[model samples]
Target: MSAIELEKDGGLWTVTLNRPDKANSLTRAMLEELADIAEAAVDARVLILTGRGRVFSAGADLDEAKAGLALSPVWERLSGAIAALPGLSIAALNGTLAGGAMGMALACDLRIAVPGAKFFYPVMKLGFLPQPSDPARMAALVGPSRAKLILMGGQKIEAPEALQMGLVDRIVEGEALLDTARGIAADTLTAKPEIATGIKRLCQG
Candidate 1:
C-alpha cells in the first residue's frame, strides 16, 4: 500500500498518512509525496491532513533517519508547501505528534487533535535541528519559551495543555475529529474561493 493517500471531495482535499503499522513514520519518499500533494493543493478551498491510526506520525522512520533522513531538506519542503497553500490548511492530528512530524502540523493554519494526542519535538535529544520554519511557527502559536520547552527541554505536552497553550485549536474525540475539521471547513468550502483565500491572506498579514 502507498504510505500516503489523497482523497478529494469537491474543493476539500484530505491527505492521510497510511502506514498505521509504522505509526505513520515518514520516509524520504513519503515526505516528497506529501510535499507534492500540498504544492498541488492550491486550488483546494480547504485541506485537511490526518493519519489512519492511533499515532499521527512518529517522525522519520528510524532506519531511514539513521541513514540520514533526519536532516533531509524534504521536511522543510513539505512544511513550506503546506504553509504556502492559499486555502485553509488544517492538521487533524489523530494521536501523538512527535519529533520532526511536528513541522507539518506546526505549519498548518489550524490544528485540531484527538483528546489522546500528545505533542513533542525532540530534536535536542536526537541531535538534529527542526525544519527551518518549525521553531518560528510553533513559537507563534505557543510562545518561544514553550517552544523551547519542547525543543530544548524535550517536554511532552498533553492535549489539554497543548490546547491551553494554543498549540492545538481544539481537542476532539477520535470519531468526531474529521467531522469537526469538516465542519470548520464548511464555510470555506462554500465561500467563493477568492473570498476565502483573501481572508486567509489578511489574517496572515
Candidate 2:
C-alpha cells in the first residue's frame, strides 16, 4: 500500500497516512510522497490530514531515523513544505500523536482530536533540540508559556487537556473526526478562495 494516500472528492483532497500497522510512523518515502502531493494540491480548496490506523501517527520510523546522519535536513525542509501548503490544511487526530507527529498536527491550520487521542512534543526526550521553527509555530498557536511547559516538561496531554491548552480546536468522537474535518472543508469552500488564501498567507508570514 502507498504510505501516503491521496483522496480527491471535488475541491477537497485528503492525504491519509496509510501505515496502520506502524501507527503511520513517517517513513522516508512517505515524507517525500507528501511533499509531492502538497505541490500538486495548489488548486485544491482544502487539504485534510489523517491516518488509516487508530493512532494518527506514532512518530518517525526508527529504521529510517539513521538518515539524520546527514543532519536531518530533509525532514525539516519537507515538513515546512507540507505545513506551508497554500491550501487550507486540517488535521484529524484519530489517536495518539507524539514527537515528530506533534509537529505534523501543529502544522495544520486547525486540528480536531478524538476523545482518547493524546498529544506530546518530546524532542527533548530524544536529547535533540526542536527545529527552530517548531517553537515559533507552537508559540503562534498556544503562546510562549504553554509552549515552554510542553517543550521543557515533555509532558503528554490527554484530549481534554489538549483542548484547554489550545492544542486542538475541538474534541470529537473518534468516529466523527474525519467526518467533522470534511464538513469543515466543505464549509470553507463556501467562502471566497482568494480571501482565505490571503489570510492564511498573512498568518504564515
Q: Compared with the true structure, what per-residue lDDT tens digits does model 2 show for residues 96-126?
A: 9877667667777899989999877777867
Candidates' C-alpha lDDT? 0.94, 0.80
What TM-score would each prediction reach against the true structure?
Answer: 0.98, 0.91
> Which candidate number has the best TM-score?
1
Regions of model 1 farther than 4 Å from truth: none
Candidate 1 C-alpha lDDT tens digits along 1-205? 8899999999999999999999999999999999999999988889999999999999999999999999889999999999999999999999999999999999999999999999988887878888889999999998999999999999999999999999999999999999999999999999998899899999999
> What is the overall TM-score of model 2 with all chains considered together?
0.91
